[model samples]
Target: MSASTPGHDDPVRPLPGWFDDAKLGVMITWGLYSVPAWAPLDDRLVRLLAEHGEGADRDRSYHAEADADGFDPIVTTSYSEWYQNSVSVPGSPTWHHHRETYGDRTYADFRDDFAAAVEQWSPEPWAQLCAAAGARYVVPLAKHHDGFLMWPSHTPNPHRPDWALERDVLGEFRDAAEARGMRFGIYYSGGIDWTFANLPILRADDVARAVPDSPEYAGYADAHWRELIERYRPAVLWNDIGYPSAAEPEKLFAHYREAVPDGVVNERFYAGTPDFLTPEYATRATSGGSKWETVRGVGLSFGYNRQEDASWTTSGPDLVELLMDVVSKGGNLLLGIGPDATGRISPEQDAALRELGAWLAVNGDAVYGSRSWRVAEDRTAEGLRVRYTERDGDLYATFLDRPSAGVSAPPRLAGAAHAECVWLGGDGTVGTVTGLAGLPVPPVRPGVPEPTVLRISPAPDPR
Candidate 1:
């Protein structure tokens, strides 16, 4: 396979079981952009349609992975977190905002402004929020492509000496999460740090060319990665873009393994078979030999997209359905939230998370500590999909759309012989059958989301 191809070859066997049980993780992307916190959520699906040939299916094109032949990454990356580099491209909307907002100021000035705002930040509340949101882990951006380190850094800043914070931001988050009994992870921009090489990527294919390549940059990234492992002992070492070519993949992996014995890594780097593969916003979902994760923004942008209103964001029901879809496909969801400059989670993002948490509070048995069934999904004649999960001899059926009416057909679990079927988060039995549980839309408080789950067991216990 070419260097740009998606898959890799290495010998990291079945990932730690704890990761498979962790159905949900929350990822925060906050940085200098959060100061301005604005980006245009372009009609990305429409852009893909325009890029694909004339006869491509419009519906499929919208959801199709952008990695197909001739597929471009530029059309897919609309993240507001990339404001620094995005603004450098002459005709982009970000560039227009930069020119109008601060005529002669550099992005470094924005960094200085962000540093001033960092004084008001605290990680405890964020950690508490994640725990409440039913997240098994929390991953925050360590250093983005912008190169502004969130924590006090021992590694030299490629461009400036005073670029990082004096406070141990990552340490604070780590302590808070560990206190909450949740694993802590770090998202490092291993491939490209704009300060080292600011390559304006205008087309989809320019992504490979954008990464800075040099022993200097490799050493810089290696130092930062080692420092993170040494200081944080992160459970998840998530990398983005790609690792610098000069960086030795094998040695880095060994170093990380030594730091955190059961450390889980994402597949974005080309080093080896990561604990899991990661498909970003516009990538194809893969499953089979290896574990995988799917990361998505609350809306179209990963950074706080000021332009994204309720219409652009996923509602509670949508999120539940999304989580079920990923789990059914044997993948985990690292739901992304972009906090504003004050470090407060957006109300929209918070609400969605809490909604998922509330649902999990009632139906967590169906999600957490569960494994995907051999047959992941079963579609009814009504076009609704019922996703399956198994745990401790009990079976779970998650409906993509809540059962507004009885499903035309529901799959019978192999040994399911329940006398009572309890609707998740609801009082009474929604359905009762020996083998299959059917729902006619269980009653729920107003504004409570759908995509309900039913616990199927041989025992008739109410609890």
Candidate 2:
């Protein structure tokens, strides 16, 4: 209830306990962009930024032709959700693809197709999938950068009349998620709306420069946020890009808190404080000792990309490892999934989510409601990666690789001579620290590469 400053050191409001305990969330990015669902299978945005600094500009010479090797981070962006902006850039693959496929068709033309596709979408399947994927929460995009609204809203887009959908997608999703005992959240692109300010956004600097500074846009975004909160009452308000300079996020946050007392806001609001920090495709060492969430797509693109296949995505084992790493470091993983315009999740993506859920079904004790241990990370004698987490007075040591015979226990666990060990999801028989040198290797499930979890009880005191 205290009014705190907007910075890492000070949060506007404390994060609810459910957020940290949730550990895993599924973010859905679907909109008009999914109608085309096309993006060059180039490197991910993070790799592109790392290869050519974020400030780097696109080559002008390649603006007239499609060069397979042409370099333009923004133009060739892997995020299909940025389709409108990418198609606006001349000569880029996305631009050329747009011209060739839908010649002379404006980006807004996809709205009709998107609407037709939505008629077939049922939020029930999505809710079921998230629940099956071991997601404690689900956040679906209400309004993406394309300025197209996914749900019917009372507050309409002034520039594009009736741009919103007729179906209450957000409300339907919220009801479905809540019915399944999962929290529901909303993602809104508050920074740049193509309808408000049509900037190609060809360069990194253009991202910020393109934010509509007009009072009209400020009021419009603010109204939309309020409407979403009033209608859906999401548990998480996940804003993307950045907020408008003209809007007062503090007032919005206050209103949101009043509406959803346990709700949390992401850091992208730009103006006011956030309940948690969001890092896209990156993770912080300690997250500055504040709660954080790592967001990344099942593949390179957050929006469905026709070009991406199984090879482009992280494997099931890798996904489990990523989750272990984040949770062990006191962070949550907000894994993203982009369904096509027809509301169909890709087979590869579906399989990966199921696989992750399968792993969680067995070893969830190490993840759910767990906190980072005193030693968050370490290496075993065999050089295999080990991550530690604590919950309910028990320590969990997750090994990235299957431990073999003679593989010594991690240094932290080596001293616990009286500790009792149990292989999670295995038989009820308990193992003890025989000599404080090595841990007994549990039988591995054939063909499954998921990380192994070991629960250890602390030594009893000599009373």
Candidate 3:
């Protein structure tokens, strides 16, 4: 087997064919944070250095009580999924918010609140949305860093025996998703369970140090991993940070495969190369050496963040482009949606998903089960961004930007008639597109979000 180096494609690849065909998966990161659903996604301390001129009495002071204007895109953008750990830092933004809002209430309070709230929420809607969005699989957070289990597991949390949810969240989600023809996955915070770690994280270096490597914690995490497989039989075991250093990676992989034959794992296990490498926020985008994925929240925060306005999230058109980009680069896009404690997908998130599903309804043939083309991206004569995917012998060219009235057939496919050209949500036969004059003026309304997909076949040889 060949692997990719810094420059060229390697024949050795780490992904199973099912993963390559998957192309799109949905990740849900709901947990205790969903209750408060507060925190930024950025590495703010990095930004603070630039703001305060490099260690010059950095402003550890909290910003305005509510979502303030001029929040640094670099600073405000952060993973809300780690709210529990961030709040433990005492002076961190989440810490300040927790102290001020809940007034010294332990994280356990928020955990209980989430568990109570989830009792009223159902998993059906989440399943329906993933199906609608054309997700190949649905991965829900089973046990996040808060050490809270969504499933009623025999493997007790080393910290709290009574802490597990009464409801079988993973089972319900698995049934719901499988009912909709989507594979089920589980996200486990295997490396760092903050309840046991309990160490303050002031810096990136502190992050790794905080994972409790004690035999007790390792044994507990190992049991949870095995129990998850024994019960749910997830298709994907998405571990976070890393696995317990003591656990045997080979044994774990063997067990996962035995439980669910097609089961795959992510690179975060840190034991060795995983079935896939995951890049956050955007696609890894390196060519053909390995199976890779880009997992990102619809908004800046993975866990729901009330502070996120419309500006923080990827719009419908933008998300389509993102998926196209990732697919073109031989990767999958694990688009994340953070539901509230009540398990409601917020309106902002819901709208984008609906639009994505609608788009996929028409253009899915170009995405699902498609392989990366030799050349990933090119441009049309009209300057529209074009991404390529191949299925069978047919080539699909997806325009990143919505084509205007006067666009052209992709430049490389110049003078070539399209086998089939379709608008994202429009039916087939959009008239043959050309390089100079794009399409025959479709009946779409102005400002409505949609992209054009051109299926090009080789022009016939001179007869």
Candidate 4:
């Protein structure tokens, strides 16, 4: 297989076909900082406090207090900022702080606390919900940049003795997904671990220094990655930022493939490009020279942000429409959830997932195990637009958006001969979709908004 070069202009290539089947997935985020019982999604209290005390000479006293308490003042100060910014701490920054301060705490201190939290983290309902909604696979954050192993690691960070999370969070998620018969994937951060390396920048210091390729850092990353691939053998490896140079991720990708031959690696490894192009927080106008998956947070934030306003949540119709639009053009959707300080996903997030799952359950036949039919038509031409995807003997002519006016049910296939249309909402009938416009228009509802889908017969051939 020929891979892309640094500055080459090439058409988007299909990632392994596995991605096509992985239309919808979930990204889970949890770590030590979540134990703080604070919401950082929308709050900036800690940041405000930090700024208030920014130039104060009290920095000296703060350091003394941190040393006496075995807490890293830099971390605490940064944590404050995280809370203020979004009520959530950034992964690398928070993890580095935790390791510096409490790396000496025994598993006896937080092991059960963390494990119990994960053991009770029943994503089965979530998975079942997603599958019911239309997701073929589920991806969990095996480990973020915090360097706190969700699985046990033999390679210990000498600097942060007690920081390794002994419990296997990924294993639990894997079992949960398999039990539900959903495919499992793992998200790994490629770089940025202050516990094992020096990042004066995150510590609020200016040091233009290169990260030393010391044995300690190498031993930690290599051993931990080996443990992840060897133990879980994840189907997909979802990664975070910090790649190409700092971590020499291409080397890691080579190692990953050698360890897990059939495993899939994302663009975060080589550079900003992934095995599939993952558009974060937004949809892409075109596939980025590869199969694509859009990973968007439910709200403005990805992690547990106690400060997030529930009113800012995403709606089921909008999300469903987004999925349809992407899948219609051949793409996948990766949704995210931030586990709270106690390792619990917020109720609001759960509701949003459930809503999506409900929508999927009703109209899943059109989504799961399907291929994009390359019909070129404008979605905005009318309220309801025609897009076809085929699976088995059925062709799905999905409505790009909602219906409007008296457009009756779903629009007909553009050039297909003699087919019946059935509304996915439990009604099976060929309703009135006659229009020269080649789309349907439904009567608008007063307040309730949802994207309606109709399955059309006489499936189109890929050729």
Candidate 5:
């Protein structure tokens, strides 16, 4: 297999088993963007034509907070100037909207807010909510491209506080989760950070552009990774944007092993291989046949998409079905939740989460600790049903679509002597399995279409 990142010529390390147990998680993304929750750049402009003409400052809060945080007020106030001059007018597709709205604010303001907000954040309730929603773990953004550290950090990011080093956000979150009996994880952006002049690596011309192998890159990596790993000791360390500019990932992995020997890492960090495979924005109905996870926000944006994009909102029922489908296929689901400026989850999002929790209370047993069945597909009474996993001698089958009424057929079964059928519901309800004596199965729709389970006993394995 390929080494982790480019030039990472080293032996691969073994992964841990707890990763298998972490089948579901909640990803939180909140930062400076959450302040104005800026609207889409193009569309918001037309809507703001009126405000702009009136000199109302389409982008407010430019330098007020930055000044308060002791940021370079003059340089910071010109952020909107830069956006208007460099991006919007020139069609540069810059994060013009983000810069215009929040560019002036320093990381200091966000840090104070984050620290205070996180302190008020009731991890107990949050973990309870996730557990209720059937999540095995919760992954919060430890650091984003903006370079703001959620936890205390003595080596502050010029713009934000060192709460990462002082307040111990990671420790508090971990303690909260353990107190609530749930696992904890973190998300870190690998290469970019607005505070770091070298950020926006894709832009290429932002800074002197040091390669990964350069001493500068090495120093940067060593410092950040060392602090995160040793301080947090996260169960899961998910990296975004990928690593390996000029340096080798083996060196980084070496640090990961030293700091968190048993922790699990995702593949986004320069290597498409980690403890599990990750699919963004959609659920995998089919088993990856390997350890995997599907990550996506409830809506189109991961963080607080101020516009409230309809595409990002996954209905409660849809969320439940998707989670069930993925788990049946032996894959995990990492759902994202966006928080507003006040650090509050949207009412709709919170309700959806609670609704998923309600469903999990009923059908989670059919999900947790389950193994995918050898057989991949089955013809059912409703239509075509896919067999995903097994739990306590029961076969769980998921219907791809709603079936028409009056159809009747027995789904194809894997090798088994006999079987009993039941729908996987909140209460353990069993339905009789009739008409399996022949082939050419019946329609699956009107005959309890969603996801149903079949109870089967296999012959004992010869020792």
Candidate 6:
């Protein structure tokens, strides 16, 4: 990882080496919004934005109070974590559900329920699950857009007194993750805080304006951020939406780096420098050459959506392929898990994660500490998709689909001397590599098909 170019005032910061090697990470988005754990279960946010064009219509105002009909985007938003803002939109699905389920109760009214649920929660299972899934790091949300803090913060919210939890959930999670030899990070919603601005974002344009720019809010956010750094010393300082315009993010970045030299900052800081870029639900080909991460939930929403079942969530095999695709393009995958109010991971999500873990336990060498190869992708004669990755001077070819016996070698491997060929998940080498013209493929398994990895030693230089 190279150092980023310095801006006019912001200093240059190099990305931490461990980040690139840490191919997979888990992000936990559990907060007050989990109490309801409800969303419309509509199309993913990326698709909605593409179809609706960011909901920006100059002719009409889409504010909920002005015209509920114009705010179709918010009504169908899939992010359950935006409950506070969503419930504020009149006639929106969330608004209707809130009225019908818990009449006249404000979003903050669920505090007691959340606290009760937190009492039953334990960080042990979460950390163990992440470790089993071959995750190299864990990032838990400390504060979200709802302005509820998961930790007992020293800087209390002025508008919502006693809004933070007495228990240090973030610290507990960090300790559990680190105990398993995984790095712990924190995610903070620095841009929009409902307690500070109290604005319901109905359109894409509303997002920018929703950020609280008041000096008081800036000082409050800065204080909380500094506290988080000084206490936890997170490996990654991830921010979402944007930072306050009134705050000096450069100073914050300097403070964080000085406190933890190897810590990295994400690109969401609207004002300061970033150690890496974070692309939500984006493909490696689409994400640029810089150190970036692809973030998305097991289901549609980062906050648990009760309506989402196995059909709506990504399958285990698909998750493995997604990680391979992202890693092949020099990117990391920060998969998200949204637990319910009781901190219980849904069965559907848990199964998928375990399946992914099972696969990683067998073929992790193809992923962890691997870099992009000469060609990111190729197709074999059997029409099977193949992704390439390189580590320790060896080339890895991952077949997305099961390949038939005696599959033909890809054109890229032609003329390359294969010192050894080992089929991951199988006993050592698959017979002997007779020639470069053809290579043997592993037998197809009975149940769910998984990506097969073939590691070729002494890879031919692509230069």
Candidate 6 lDDT (Cα, whole model)?
0.79
Badly placed stretches (over 4 Å) of model 6 are 1-12, 43-72, 286-288, 431-435, 443-449
Candidate 2: where are CA atoms >4 Å away?
A: 1-12, 43-70, 434-436, 446-449, 459-463
- Which of the two, 2 or 4, has more lDDT? 2
lDDT of 2 by residue, 1-463 (tens): 0001122333546679999899999999999999999988754444543332211222111112223465555667777888888888888888999999999999889999999999999889899889988999999999988788988888888889879899888888889899999999999988878888856776643565567889999999999999999988999999876778678888999999999999999877766778887656665554237687877788877889988899887777889988988898888999899999989999999888888888898899999999987777778777888888889988888998888876787766766767788878777645676434666667676544568888888622211
**lDDT, candidate 4, residue 359?**
70
lDDT for 89 in candidate 5 is: 27
Order of the predicted models by TM-score, top scorer first: 2, 6, 1, 3, 5, 4
lDDT of 5 at 253: 65
Query: Candidate 1 has which clashing residue pairs, if any?
Result: 72-204, 73-204, 74-204
Please list all clashing residue pairs in model 6, or write none if there are none.
none
Rate residue 278 of model 4 by lDDT: 55
Q: For candidate 1, write residues 1-463 as lDDT tens digits.
A: 0013244554366688889999899999988888877665656544653443222211122323454465443433457886776677777777788788878787777777787777898898899889988999989999887888888887868677787877788899889999998999999988768778855555644555667888899999989999999989999999876788678866888888877888888766767667887655422232244676767776767778777777777777778877877776677888889888878887888888888877788778888988876666676666766877878867687877656665554544533454456677777765566545344666565555677777666432221
With a 3 Å backbone cut-off (N, CA, C), the pairs that clash in candidate 2 are: none
lDDT, candidate 4, 261-346, per-residue tens = 65666654435324665544445443223566666567544556565556655666667776776676667888777776456667
For candidate 5, lDDT tens digit of each residue in 365-394?
A: 656777766554455544555445666666
Q: List RMSD in Å for every model shown.
A: 4.8, 5.6, 7.0, 10.1, 10.8, 5.3
What local distance difference test score does each model get?
A: 0.73, 0.79, 0.71, 0.54, 0.54, 0.79
lDDT of 6 by residue, 1-463 (tens): 0001112223246668899899999999999999988988644444533332211211111111113335354545677888888899898889999999999988888998999999999999999999988899999999998889999998999998889999999999999999999999999988878888856876654665677879999999899899999999999998877778677998998999899999989877756778777656555453235687777788777889998999888888989998998888888889899999989999998888888888888888889998888788878777889888999998888999877767887767765664578778776776435344556658554443499888888666542
How big is the positional error of residue 253 in model 3, measured in Å on the Cα after superposition?
0.2
Runs of candidate 1 with Cα error greater than 4 angstroms are 1-5, 45-77, 282-287, 404-408, 411-420, 428-432, 435-441, 445-447, 458-463
